[model samples]
Target chain A: MKKTTLFDIISPVMIGPSSSHTAGAVRLGLLAKHIYKNTPKKVKFTLYNSYAHTGKGHGTEKGLLAGVLGLDVDDRRIKDIFNSDIAKNIDYTFSYADNFKKHPNTVDMVFDDSMFVSGESVGAGEVAIRKINDFNVKLTGRYNNLILVYKDKPGMISQVTNLLQKEGINIAFLNCDRNAKGQEASMIIEIDGKMNTSIEDEILKIPDVYFVTYVEKLEN
Target chain B: MDTFEQLYKECLTKNKTIYQAAQENMAIEADISVDKVRSFALKSLFEMKEAIRSGLISKELSMSGMCGQDCYKVQQYYKKQNSMFGKLFEKIIEYALATSEENIRMGRIVACPTAGSCGIVPAALIAISEEYNCSEFEQINALITAGEIGRIISLKVALAGAVAGCQAECGVASAMAAAAVCQLRNGRVSQILNASALALKNVLGLTCDPVAGLVEVPCVKRNPFLAVHAITAAELALCDVESKIPLDEVVDAMGQTGALMSPMLKESSQAGLAVTKTGLKVQKQVFD
Candidate 1:
């Protein structure tokens, strides 16, 4: 009954075979690409449980690799993934893990031997990346310019807000996830914002801020 | 009965009755009895050929017909030629004929549910169609029987993309094809529904992940396997066997299972296929 269902049925173009195994994989990958610090060089993908077993057949391998390469799901090159020259540009390998504790389609990616991104393909173009490298965060990437980090001492939120205000950006939603007051915690800020190259530099410069990343919302 | 339960029951009973009536109408030849379901399938096939040969359906139309029965619902797909159902219907029959010809030539066939999933259904459907020269009426009867099975799944397991992903799409398509095969083989409607239930139950949470967000890559080939699976399940059911639970129960279970399924597994491509590294790469390449 959801509107997305009708859109999917009505969409003129859909990649072959299955929707979840292909389209959703690309969306998740695109999110990760935006979040990563740089274009990844060497990537290691650890597929947990069912993903490790049946993923290859479903073209998850191509889907994941294409995502790291920052390709959209509609690209025709996806079919040539196994033999693409672009795929050669990135060093990628896949392995399986026995972690059922994670979602069935969980993929833990180690990007360029630096950033460790862990996420699950929830289904139908939806994903939740629980961790990006060491920074712990949960986001669906449904909108543009999402920022998450560990909340620090007092005035940090105010300072962050002032910095965004200086950049002529407005905050749409700022959600903080904390265990206890004054303790180390996480915050997710969804904003009507865009990272203009300097945004990352500005946020990373903040003390107590572990890391900074950007996410662009995918169109339905 | 609960809503899902009642729907499943209705599907099973109706499917059974239609199949029985169809089978009872099949005329025999050469010391062998033809199946009503096969007869119906063959008739559909012949009609497709006639439409194509008479220019009511063209090569393009026939090719589109390979997409199966669902194509009729959205006639605007061929807006270049004008949005017309009459033309679309002709094309639909042409595609069905072409698809059938391709399957027969390919030899190892897969029948998509009815001729709709003919690419997959016939992988199983033609095997029986060829085995027995079933008439067009019998094929329609078998399709109606299969439709009941499909309806049961739609009510219980979900035909909507938001629910069970591509699993319900092609998976249910395969299940329906298998049930029709059972009917053609003279299996009781209960048996036919059982085969359908078994097929759906076996592949419950399959995801719909079209690589590159296009319905090209795995979608075309996947139908054939679904057709093959339908045949396998039907054969299993016809061997004096039935699901320990009735078809309706399986439908109910499939619906609940789809409900509990994650949104990622649905057709959004945001999850299984859309979220992968390769998925992103393909997407970027496309948009860039």
Candidate 2:
């Protein structure tokens, strides 16, 4: 279990109405932004279950858009993000759905129809990115993460861990997913220490490694 | 660190107050200085006060039009007549409503435990501090004491309405507020714990059924009600009244009760007041 701190219990001074719906939505968008690594020309957000039903009143849509545009959870501009100048550059639309299989407060961010990042607002303004396109991944935005997409091959995990070992960086959690044998695969590494572009550059140099992104932990 | 019993033992052994023990423990857990922890808490305190200041003057309705003018109405009422309970009571209710109304209006607030129950702890702690002329340092101590209470309870139960119910959100907030108020009143460590236990044990099984699934209906008004509820527990504890159940045991029971509760009543908007006749109408009005 993750350790609960006094800050986790009493802090995160944020724009409110509902923590799971509003603040968590913003976090999901922020994480999605980090995972995407850049802003897209267009994005479509699909809110599911409880988020679909009550998201508007709680400003979930605004939160998601504001976050995608790099707004923090506490930014007062989130309330009118639709009219904000920063939001003018990106075309955004929202669609609602009811999928019982999905978590009650789930959203899918389709960026430029090229990247699909699905995340859930898991109670108390905490979130977990569950899927990135076709690959299943787990990202809580708690620790700095190193994400990689590559062709499935033997020893893909060792090659990555070996690089971190050389750097004296500790791996806290590692999750790997593949479509099938010898097919596309993805790796999500949650590390205990800081990340530098040098590590990401080295990972991208590995054979069959197509993508690499270093996501810094969210600043609360 | 995981249970109130352990926290109590540590406090007794170290001969420290709840805030002292809590800040030290948090400093170690978070790997930061005690001063950093207090500074973060002070930041939230200032935000809470700012929310109250902004909310007290605004009468604008929330996006759903269900709430937002309530704090203004209360302010108006107090101007015409004082509350039967007196000045402290007026401050508590006004502050509670102001914070909550600000929330639905998409204003800033400190989610003490959560945004839904954001008003409870601040209203109780801030009101008492103002009424008693407590120092900023004393207020920080009380706030840390409240955070410690919530953190311990959260170890036993997740402090979210979706995970447990309102019992875990507003219920836990009230308990935290009771502990904060008790600490501000200079109650002993045992009495502080007793105050929280008294608050938690009474509000067990409280459902989280917001009308139209919005935090406006019961959530906005419930803050002031529960803020006062917290004071009752503090008053009782300060007078040497004790809960037969220990604080840890009460939290355990709360966890059990939440598990036994129907999912429909756990922030799903499927049963209870969320599905009432007017609830359905409000839902349609808001969504359709």
Candidate 3:
């Protein structure tokens, strides 16, 4: 069973009209921003289904933009984020689509025409970052995570786990997906301890490693 | 941790009230002190109060011009004539509207279980606290009890209208409020649990059928109605009324009911009130 804290139920003071559409959108954006690791010059947001239908009234667009700009969900500026100076610094656009295959409240944030992060507001104020780029992954932003894209190889998993074990870090969850044998693969590791640049650098040192990014947990 | 039965057992064995057990367990899970847990609840409590304060005076319509004045209208009505249900009833209704309207206007509010149902717990707890002159610490304890109720129900079903319809969102919020109000009134642990059970048992299958797919219309008005619904549960529980079925069983039934419900009624706006003629016209006016 998932261990839900008391604070999870009663808290997360936020600007809202809907948790799934508004606050949850901000969280999805925050996770996407963390995965991207840097502010992109432009972002294209494709809102799906319910998010597409009622997103404007719920301020889903504003929440997504404000989050990418590093604003917390409770930030009052989210209501008028479009007029904020921070929003002016970046180029962003919102497009709508209907995909019954996707979660009702799903969004894809494409940054600078390169990185694609798709997430869904799973209900309450919780969200899951389901896809980063083309790699299918699961991230709930509940723990410090290390995401790596590398060539699929036999020793990749052991190599990564060995490093984490040496550092006395506990792995809460880990998922690795590859398109085919010995092809491009993605590793998503949720850890119970803190993460730093040194740990990320060690993962990058491994041969065939293509990309590495550390995603910090979202604040409650 | 998964069931209210376990929570009751833990509380009994540990000689703690529902809030005490909940706070201690959360403190251990989050690796924070129990005081820290209380402090977090306290912060949310203050924010809830602030939302009510801001909402009470503002008649500003939402971006869609659908809601945001109902709270003002209710306040005016109450000023001219008191509710037959009394001042506590009037306060709960007025505060629930204020907080929910504030939410539609993009104002800050504590998402008790969820933003759509944020008003219920605050309206019930704050109104009762004021009526009875409860202390801040007592109010926090009541709030924590409410949180535990929500947290437990959420374990069985995700508290989202899209997931389990409004039964999980506003229905659960009403249950949480019942638990909080029961605790405030010095009810026993069983009574508090029973209060929540009554609330949940009664609101099973409440659909998430907001008109125009917005959190207005039924969503805004539903807050006050459910807040009052919570009081009814608390009143019954305080008088030693039992829910026949256990709280855990009620939650199980709710989960099953949500699963059997059609997808169209689960925040999709394809059925129920969302697709009514007036609902369709409003949708066109707002979105087109």
Question: Which model scores highest in TM-score?
Answer: 2
Question: What lDDT tens digits, residue by residue, belong to model 1 across residues A65-85?
Answer: 877787776566765676998
Error of 3 at B156 (Å): 1.6
Candidate 2, residues A56-168, lDDT tens digits: the string is 98999999998899889899999999999999899999999999999989999999999999999998898999999999999999999999999998888999999999999
- Give per-residue CA lDDT, model 1, range B248-267, as digits (tens): 67666667777788876664
Cα displacement (Å) at residue B257, model 3: 2.0
Model 1: runs farther than 4 Å from truth?
A1-9, A148-151, A162-173, A177-185, A193-206, B1-90, B93-288
> Can you write out model 2's per-residue Cα lDDT over B1-288, one digit (the tens) per residue?
788888889889989999999999989988899999999889989999999899899998989998999888888989999999999999999999999999999999999989999999999999999999999999999999999999999987999787789999999999999999999999999999999999999999999998988998889999999999999999999999999999999999999999999999998888999999999998899999
Instruction: List the candidates' TM-scores in order.
Output: 0.48, 0.98, 0.97
**Candidate numbers, best DockQ first, in rank order:** 2, 3, 1
Docking quality tier of model 3: high
Model 3 over residues B23-65: C-alpha lDDT tens digits?
8889988899999999999999999999999999999889889
Query: Which is superior by TM-score, 1 or 2?
Result: 2
Evaluated at residue B49, the lDDT of candidate 3 is 100
TM-score of candidate 2 versus the correct structure, residues matched by position: 0.98
True contacts kept of 1: 0.02
Residue A185 Cα positional deviation in candidate 1, in Å, after optimal superposition: 4.2
Cα error, candidate 1, residue B130 (Å): 31
